[model samples]
Target chain A: MFYDNEMTLSFRAISSNEAFARVSVAAFALQLDPAVSEITEIKTAVSEAVTNSIIHAYDNGDGIVHIWCGCAGNKLYIEISDNGKGIENIETAMEPLFTTKPEQERSGLGFTIMQSFMNNIEVSSELGRGTKVTMEKSIGE
Target chain B: MSVGFKTLNNCLIVEIDGEIDHHFVDNVKKSIDSQAVQKGYSNIIFDFKNVDFMDSAGIGMIIGRYKFTKKNGGITSVACLSDNLKRIMMVSGLYRIIKIYNTVEEATKAV
Candidate 1:
């Protein structure tokens, strides 16, 4: 089935923009009229993905992060991409409590939270190219 | 990024206001850690009365504090959590380790 509604947002990979990206996705997903819990789930998952891009991608430098959200029927689809240093070991990165920036208080639970909140999540990356994460959740489930 | 700290009898009650995400979870951790560990506090009560929202980053921040307090033989508890915050923490299994009370006073009493 095709998306009944879709929106794309592009912003600088900055820590401050994390909140903007989360709220923007949440607002767009609101079109599905999800429950309060569903809304929070999307907001939290989006925040985690956007934060990872800002922290791991740009590494305090500069880059672009793109977020795309769409809804069809009761399913919400989200994609967050960044053009920066990509993950070396996708499996290791997805492991619970595995964070490269341990000294920075990173619990390495970003992907864990996303997977737990959403129905599905896919992470694709290239060593020197970039990374893209796609996730989806069904409302009222 | 404001956290109000009230120290009472070696217990620190933190009033966490505003939305908590990666944007300010670091500051929250720093502020609470300084007061809990450096100030020699034995119990930490996170008063989430004003916390509007919290993402996974908040969970990480709380875990970091929990670990720090554990090393010092301190107790960690939460109070006044919004429904959203409570659900997020619950799904992350935070309630299993940290006790949640309806009020800061209740948490302190149990401590």
Candidate 2:
């Protein structure tokens, strides 16, 4: 069987849009017939990525967060990006419990949760430019 | 999302309805914190029976509350977790600092 689908969404980098982004991605991935647990994991990962963009990239100022999703042959691909202040160091940022905003009560487990939930995750950024996170997960065997 | 609080014997049981994520966490945190302060309650029991989804933001909120409660010589506990929420809780290592109960009554009694 050959299965292929793709979608792109862009919205303001605001807190309210976090739920909208994750639910929309989960709905799109429903075509793969993912299990409930799998769907939950995907939604969690998406939420983390989008939250990062809103809090870190845009600094809760004013910007747009973009999401691109494509599924091919039981595999889901997601790319969340923001054109805001980017990470200074990708390596340190990916480390567990590493957050710049500890005063905000951040657990710094966003990247860790995404890494564990998805099969693969890659982050790329240019300081003072922007950041993009790409992740992949297989659904329903 | 709506949050209902029940205070029983100095323990505030927070009954959360709907999803817990970055979008609505601020409200939940504000509600619970203010209630805790106004009622002079220290310990908090989060009843997750009705919550369907949560993410890292939920983890942050819980940890924040836990820290605050701990400073006040109180405890933080969670009750009635679904499998998905359990997975997230375990992955985050929240079990180390927060107690888990099977039911709201158990959590309230523990406090």
Candidate 3:
């Protein structure tokens, strides 16, 4: 089924907006009538993706995070993108424990958590250009 | 998020309220660390009964505390985790290093 509904949000890449971003996405996802666990999982995935954009992509203290969410039938789709410093190596960034900012005490589990919660995830990036993460999940499965 | 601290049985009980995320993690960490130092308590038990959400930032904070307590010959444990939080904990392999209890009272007695 094609996505019948969608919403887009763009916010400053700030830590305070992390919770705001996830809550907004989760609210939009309520139309799917997802189970409590399913919604919680979606919220977590949103949080992780937003955190990566704010902390890693815009670590230089400036950038905007864009999120686009769409839903159709029982499936939800999400795309989070940032135009800050792009990832140098997408493969290394996706690894479970490979974090470039170890000094910040990052667990480097952001992508892992997103993958665990969503049905599938894809990442694309270009040096000095930007990074985009797309994730999909089927609810009530 | 709001954090409440108390010293029970020589264990620092850090009760966290509301969402645990990157936005509030630094403040939470500072509060817990300062309380532990002032009270001279090495063992710490996180009370998450009221936590609405958590992410990787919480995991990092927990691991950092685990190392701090372990180096001080103490232990770090969590109490009152929702099933959703437990799922994240499992994915992060945090259960390998710390223990979980049904209540802070049980953790205080054990730690």
Candidate 4:
């Protein structure tokens, strides 16, 4: 027998309200059986990515955040991509405790939390181009 | 998410509702620390009665608070954790450092 399942969702990266949509997607994809902890982790990670795009990428506060998810062979994959002011230095941004918005008290731990939650994280960004974050996690059945 | 704080025997009693995830960890930490400092409360009792979910970030935040309180010669306790949060706390090794109480009153009194 062969089993192949995939899911995808796309929405504007405009407001925090949209972040909640990703949680619903993850929850539904997991058949509502995911551990509460797992669900929370995925939601937070997605929120961080989307917020980064809204605040950093689309500094004008208007753009689209594309998200895609797929499940294959007991592994879940999530991709969040944004076309905006691309990152100049991905290395510095990923560092813990580094934030551009110091006045806002941003912890700059978004990428760190995402990496910690997911099994694998791959970031692709180009100055003046865009950013795409690919994350993968293994589901326990 | 629901957040409320009160004072008991000079200790701060923080009641958390809804999911305690990374999204709210920083806010919760900052709020509690600021309140404790402002109100001059050395000890803190976290009431998790209404919390339905938590993740590793939540554990990290709790451990961080424990250290903060410990350094000040104060203590921290947790109360009414849901079974899921309890298991996560156990796996994250939080139970080893922070004391757990059956009720908020007990935790407040112990501190």
Best by TM-score: 3
lDDT measured at residue B6 in model 4 versus the true structure, 0 to 100: 96
Give the worst 10-residue stretch by lDDT in candidate 2 chain B. Answer: B22-31
Q: Who is ahead in DockQ, 3 or 4?
A: 3
> A31-108 in candidate 1: lDDT tens per residue?
888898888888889999999998997786799999898899989999999989999999999998799998887778
Q: What docking class should model 1 receive?
A: medium
Q: Write the per-residue lDDT of candidate 2 for residues A70-134, one digit (tens) a residue.
A: 99988999999999999999999999889999988788999999999999999999988899999
TM-score of 3: 0.98
Clashing pairs in 1: none
**DockQ, per-model, please?**
0.67, 0.86, 0.89, 0.15
lDDT of 3 at A60: 35
Query: Can you rank all candidates by lDDT, best first?
Result: 2, 3, 1, 4
The superposed Cα distance between candidate 2 and the true structure at residue B36, in angstroms, equals 0.9
lDDT of 3 by residue, A73-96 (tens): 889999999997889989889999
True contacts kept of each: 0.59, 0.82, 0.85, 0.05
For candidate 4, the iRMS in Å is: 5.7
Order of candidate numbers by TM-score, starting with the best: 3, 2, 1, 4
Q: Is candidate 1 or candidate 3 better by DockQ?
A: 3
Ranking by DockQ: 3, 2, 1, 4
lDDT of 2 by residue, B1-111 (tens): 889989887899899999998877877788888999899999999999999899988999999999889988898899999999989899999888888899988887877
The runs of at least 3 residues in candidate 4 whose Cα sits more than 4 Å from the true structure, single-residue gaps closed, are A1-3, A31-37, B20-45, B53-111
Model 1 misplaced regions, further than 4 Å: B37-39
